[model samples]
Target: MKQFREEWDLDSIYVVDSALYSSDNFQQLRQLRWITLVTASLKVVNILVESLGEETFEDIEVPGYRIASCCSDYGGVRQRWLVVESESGRAQ
Candidate 1:
């Protein structure tokens, strides 16, 4: 990300899978002012479920993020997508 900003003079938005979702990675990205759109892991979904307890996604609020979209497979598994942006990006 630093290279992209300094060398290429580009602002990059990352779309990463659950495998890359970690507290350390999130902190690094936040520190660097990079935005990421990621697939929410089952662990994250579970935490939301536990916290909300029967409430819908619309009621959830993540300090630096907005729920961009969600999809579910009622027949089988469920998946969620979350878009995380910086406070600066939220203004634009």
Candidate 2:
């Protein structure tokens, strides 16, 4: 990320997967103005379930999908996270 910022002189948000969920990476990115859309890992999902329970999720309407979100902290930075479910995803 530092390299991307320094070399390209660009500051853009990235929608990332669980691979970028490390605290070190987030801490670095947070310093920049890079917004991250990280898919929640099982550990994060479990913590949210344990801390806030299911009551906190609010329904969100997206074009063709049923979505829901909850606000929580990730790597000490507060942000909203979304969860999408499908039978095939569960089978994995």
TM-score of structure candidate 2: 0.57
Best by lDDT: 2
Clash-forming residue pairs, model 1: none
Off by over 4 Å in 1: 1-8, 31-44, 53-92
State the lDDT of candidate 1 residue by residue for 20-78, as single tens digits: 55565554345343333334355655454345422233423666543334453322434
- Candidate 2, residues 6-89, lDDT tens digits: the string is 776555666565577777787766755544555455577767645653454444564333345777676788676665544454
lDDT of each: 0.45, 0.60
- After TM-score superposition, what is the CA distance of residue 43 in candidate 1 from its true location, in Å? 3.9
Clashes of 1: 0
